[model samples]
Target chain A: MTHELLPSGIDLLDSALNGGFTKPSNFLLIGTPLSAKKEVGLILLNGGLERDEAAIYISTSNTAEEARSHWEDYGFKEQWEEEGRVKFVDCYSKMLSATVSDTPSIRRVPSILDYTKLSVAVNDWCTSYYLQNTPVRLMLDSLSAFLIYSSLQTVMRFLHIFLGQLRKQNALGFFLLEEGAHEIVTFNQLKTFSNGAIRVNEESNMMQLEGYRHGMNIPLPSAVVPKATAEASQVSCTPTK
Target chain B: MFKSNGQTTKVPTGISIVDTLLDGGMPNGDSFLIRAHPLADPLSMVIEFLHNQLKNGGVGVFLVNNKSPASVLEESAILKMGLRDFKRNGQLFFIDAYSALFGLRSNEAYFVEDPNNPVSVSKVVAQALSECSKKGKVFFVYDSLNTSIDEFGNAILAEANTWKRIAIAFNAILCFIYTEWNYPKDISEAVANLFSSIVDLITLERIVATQVVTVSKNEGTPVSKRMVPIKNAVTGGIKGYVPKILVTGPFHAGKTTLVHTLSTRAVSVQRMGTTVALDFGHVNHRGFTLDLFGTVGQPRFDPILERLGGEALGAILVVDSTKPEEFPRAKEMMHKAGVHGLPYVLAANKQDLPDALSVEEVKKKMNISDEVAIVGTVGTDKVSVVKVLDLLLDKILST
Candidate 1:
């Protein structure tokens, strides 16, 4: 039996998913900087806002105000910010602030195990942000940052831990990462770990999105994850009169 | 009240709820930023203070000095403070200075956009505060200190000194200074500590409890200290403490059934019967709430479950006392939970089934060396279920 789906505020995207993202599932969105990956994440996230579900966006790049202003253009800025359903956790700051000053213990660091620990830390941080009986939709803007800081084996373990928490909470979440960072093996492993994933790309200097056989594969505008180009078929570029 | 007494005793009209938070009310002219965790009601507290002033029919005047554009400031104000009738009282005036932040136009006030030009920023703010303070009953808020920290850089000290000077001159100038946020715990703590020492009052809103507002931190040596728990008034909605516990065991060890048996409300979102994803439920016993999360016995899924259920204080590692051969995985799960210093219990489930490993045999394989308790249980029976919970609670209470 299907339950109520939260709309991402982008009409085409909401309708594309037959409403919105299914609750209690983990999905991935992959693209480069300015890929509109964050935009798509915000759409799903803002949908939760409409439902009065608390949504948290862990930004590895964008500022909270910048993210708010971008959504303001679509008339969701106030609802997302004021009513307090949406939040941003800047992981960039968290990681940057972590003191790597401890004397480096040179014991054999199990690449997979180390990554798992980092993942646990990330999950702990996310869990603490949750307040209210508000159903939550969590978005981690860039997993590549996690990967860059830790080993690839660790990244996989991290993903496993990260995805595991979301599933346990029955929350809808997305882990964003860059396309070229990992090899095919890691990609396949992540795809298997996730219930759904979408591949976003920039082609012919315009943005385009494709399905990864896990998440909604629809190419509709509202369902589109941002890519590098602003001229993606999904977004209207005409100046307002 | 505007006697020639050199003291500027202009107290902020803190709303009843918030005034109660500040121990009667904030002193007339102290400068402090509203410290907030990722999601604290800083704006609400400010508005409530305004509401209290209006409700009491006090003659207080507020001048909102915006360093950003007027449109941006107005839009944000509208979003935060809805245009309700209570907000329409005639004591508030808004000064649009957003243009000043971007090197734009200003009338009679020189804009301060350059960090190197602290002289200009300081001069402009000082002039505005001075003019506003002359109105007898006035409260000053800088909206945010984070922006000033950005524009002032290391010169934040100069900006702070400016506040110190303002407070000394007009003791009623309660300056709200906001610092830029990056969520670097150390940085935020350092800023909080620094501000706490200098400011007469410091209150921080840390979003720790789920959907509940409990005072997280207060450091200003108030006349009294009290923590207020704020909840949704209408729905009485709350995301109260739901401890996340993990249940694991060998294949078909009644792990799923155990969760269903013990849980008051439960659901499984696993793709495969072997729990490919995860399981969730809530356990209620005599007022304590335990949220149980379970995973299948497969090795590949074990780490994922362990990592997700990190730093748990309560874990129930289930073992099928009925299956002697599948005891190893149960022991392994117990060992993992122990590594994180989590207090756990052993549930020797399916005790009624024939050829069941006795509780002793199951505990031996698990090396019941420590004082951790073990209980023989039939996942379906309520009597057996309550016993298991009692054991878990005992472990929790003891710890």
Candidate 2:
């Protein structure tokens, strides 16, 4: 059976995966402390944004303002935000008791502990963008924050539903997790639901690619994080027979 | 029959601009709403009003909702007005409502058992007025209607209505301070309509939080509607002040564009498509006169930057978003302008470009601390330009 491939915005990784990860796939990014995990997520979103594809960043760790500042740092423009091609589901500010005013591109949830509210906000964003008939990039900054706040069983349940929705909408999903933060059994359980996974070692500054049910498990070359290229970040998914 | 004096029987609010706006002073036996933002404190205005009333030989009654009577007294003493002396003379009194919120009984001259109970609060105010009114025209100050609304819910409207009736019946000047931008639109509108006159204490951002007083509405008088900048007087009350802002950045970072965008009248000394010397613009925002000076971006124009940087209350450092390499130059320009340790905002320009870096990237490359505000801007985008200015002003005021 043939599967569509979506570029991960990293040249070596894209070439190693025989073009990219299969479309409609959920990819988990496991990184050690102070690794380039966030950079990878940004590259992926910028990849979609460069192609003018709609993208949504569900931020649990940073306020929407902080996220926007990061996006602009990587050479991304605000035109995409103004045009409604980019959106942020902010679940961080209210934790600090700061009021999050509603805007077109941002939906501020009352708290990160409110899994139901976060899911609703993400679902609403997906529903609207799904109608656009273009591929979408959905990034959850880090799952560890969620795990810290919620029970393992509860977070697993939420991700099961969330990943299922991403697959249904043909959206590319990136879920970030901290290495060694959870047990091996927890990793195995999450791995079962994800189609592919990449682990980043801050000490070695290298990323290892692994497949769950597919081939292309070869370790790629040293990942040279691209230095702020506008076009290099614009990788897209193309269907193949 | 009410004796008609040559001038209206009015109580000066202590804010000279506010008094001038109200056609000399707030008319006696009338209620006025002082709308302000929650972060913007109007307590100084209230305290000044009370001091003015005391000076005029009129008794003052302050219904405290958000602050403790002790805090009020401390703040009043800062103005050199001894609240204890006024209380001893039966010229000043406080009805503490904040203590009830904390489930504590206050030892103030008067206390409300239930701040949410409008009838009980009204009864206390009525009894106090009976005792105080004999002295002269009483000044009734409800420190804030918004705080009361928060505690008592919609009952505050009815409570205000009762206070209005009492003000009329007792021939006292009633002032209701409502924090602006904190209530629901419909509720704020409904409350605003209840007042015969509205004194809007608008907080404008510069290097520091400056205020302006405007009489938006006055039933019996011709309101000036003039924006008058207000400053805290050394002794007491608030006076008038102006703010000057400096706009400086690296070459081709859009400093000229920003100055042009914010300035009502902008003059630029440009030769060969670049600012050769400097750019000057003037903006009169909400009664505050802002003199905006735009420094030339070229490194060769360091002398001009230094000259414009002096006496600037605040500064804005504009940098090109797509050019991270230029951020160092931007920082250098800021230091050369003598804006070190001074309040300033970073304007990340060219954000409309596809190659533009995010504000975070610029901050990282420039080594800017998180505390310093960095706002995105696109040339010719009015909203983006205004947002940058507002952030710069907010940072200035906050510092």
Candidate 3:
């Protein structure tokens, strides 16, 4: 079936997937240690930036500042980030006990082990971006860190709720996974939840997308959580323009 | 209004809702921990707290641990907190627990040679606090409890208790910037019990992550535990808090766009970009933080309108400028939402479309009262949408 997809900016992969990824979609990029999964993830991330889409990077392996600079090195626009269009949820910095002060462009996540906080961080970013009526693209640098820190069941539970929220919000999400990082059960379990996965070959750097246009459709876990706040000194009346 | 720890006057953080929530601001010599999620800005809160303290002729003592004092001062400059000025004027003092140990230096008067030395760090912090409080009302903040813990294990919590006592002794309010780093549960609970009030920076998933602040442990008066939406630091602080304001209209009337355009951060409980559930957003505008709730326009969703408009301070009724026929439907939805008596503004949206009508024309079609301001708006234009909110807020504030 044809779909209006956001191109991954990789011509070969774009053609293989019939243009690119569908909106309201979540796709996993699986590749071995030396494969191009990270490269592919960054390209899509950068592509989203070029298209003026709000992009969020959940970096478990690197500090938000590091992820940002690395993305910048790949020619991502600085203005988008400066303007709040690009945000990073760092599960890396504070994990290393590096005390970077709070700022808008980046947020600190306490630990990789705390998947709940990590999910909430992304949820916050996606919501913040959704205010403007633009598509949001979320890229997790690699899922290996999460798998390493947490059980597959926990990571799967996180992804199910996380990706389901993205789909509901019509966001396009790409989660990178290092092949062989976990048991085959990890990959098999993820496939059941994801719409499909794009796998890059170990030696050839070639790619092929697996089918599951509509994932297993497991019902997303439901939990009701409530609302937000902004700064407040005084509310002296200002006449309207 | 509520006194604890024998503090003098209540010191305002300048954020209106918080002051009200804290019952006219945190009292001097009172201690509270702002336990924030990594995404929340405790620094901005600290800056605003210190700024108000300085402005009111009180003194501020900053015990730096997370970052160097120089870096703290340098970074806070973005908010124009005037730390340097306050320091020069003798109203602000910095105890360098981070800089001297790292071989860097700020022009701070007090410095600890070894930050890891609990007694030495305690001595320097206490000395800075004692010196600053002697001047008058004092606001002391431990830049971070999380980093202090990393630098000196679970002992930081013990140290925090000591500082709290010292601040209380001097009648100076103490604040600690603590971030949750998956510390031990018992220690986390212990840290919570150490403070009189806790301002938690929590993220709630209303389909999207929305940063919220809740106040608890406030003794003497009832703390509603009001969950307020927060924005990225605005120069002076959070301007004001309007808990709820409704954005109602017919489906496809640009209600979502209007909400999006006006909010600093927003999320719609939607499917495929259509607000099937509801839209929520926060905007710090014209010296107020307005929480906008955009309702699902379909009649099937009308049942939820009453809840959506439950406590809304005011409302914005969005309508398609070109389609006068749907005007009644928009009003009907608001009526069903039980917001008839509320002061609201009419947003004549889609004004950018070729067939759209003018603001006056939209007003005429809806037969809306003259008291309700009518604004012509293109949802894509932030200016026009803000104007709509501004008019509604003006009416809301007046009432």
Clash number by candidate, in order: 27, 9, 22
User: Which segments of candidate 2 are over 4 A away from where they belong?
Assistant: A1-241, B1-8, B205-209, B220-224, B233-235, B245-399
lDDT over C-alpha atoms for residue B341 of model 3: 91
- For model 3 chain A, the run of ten residues with the poorest summed lDDT: A220-229
Give per-residue lDDT, candidate 1, residue A101: 21
| Recovered share of real interface contacts in candidate 1 | 0.00
User: What is the two-chain DockQ of model 2?
Assistant: 0.01
Q: Give the candidate number with the greatest TM-score.
A: 3
List candidate 3 segments past 4 Å from native: A1-40, A44-125, A132-135, A138-241, B1-9, B97-120, B134-137, B149-153, B180-185, B201-203, B208-214, B220-222, B227-233, B247-332, B335-399
What is the lDDT, from 0 to 100, of the residue B233 in candidate 1? 23
- Model 1, A167-240: lDDT tens digits are 55556787887787787776777767675675554443322333322233334243343342243454532211
lDDT of each: 0.53, 0.73, 0.73
Per-residue lDDT, model 3, residue B21, is: 64
Q: What are the per-residue Cα lDDT tens digits for candidate 1 across B185-233?
A: 6546555554422221221222233322222222244323333333322
Off by over 4 Å in 1: A1-199, A204-241, B1-12, B51-120, B150-154, B175-186, B193-225, B231-399
Task: Give the DockQ ranking, best first.
Answer: 3, 1, 2
Candidate 3 on B1-399: residue-level lDDT in tens? 344346546666777767766766776666888887644557777787788778888888888764556555554575767577888888888887765543665567888788777878888887887777778888888877766665566677777778878888998888888876556688688788888777777655455445666786674333556666565554555544577899999999999988888899999998887899999998877556778899998888778999899867788999989899998898788888888899888888999899998888887777878778888889999888888887876676455
DockQ of 3: 0.07
Chain A, candidate 3, TM-score of 0.81
Cα lDDT tens digits, model 3, A101-219, are: 55787877655644544665677677767767777888988888877644565566567666767776788888888887778888899878778887765443345566642221111
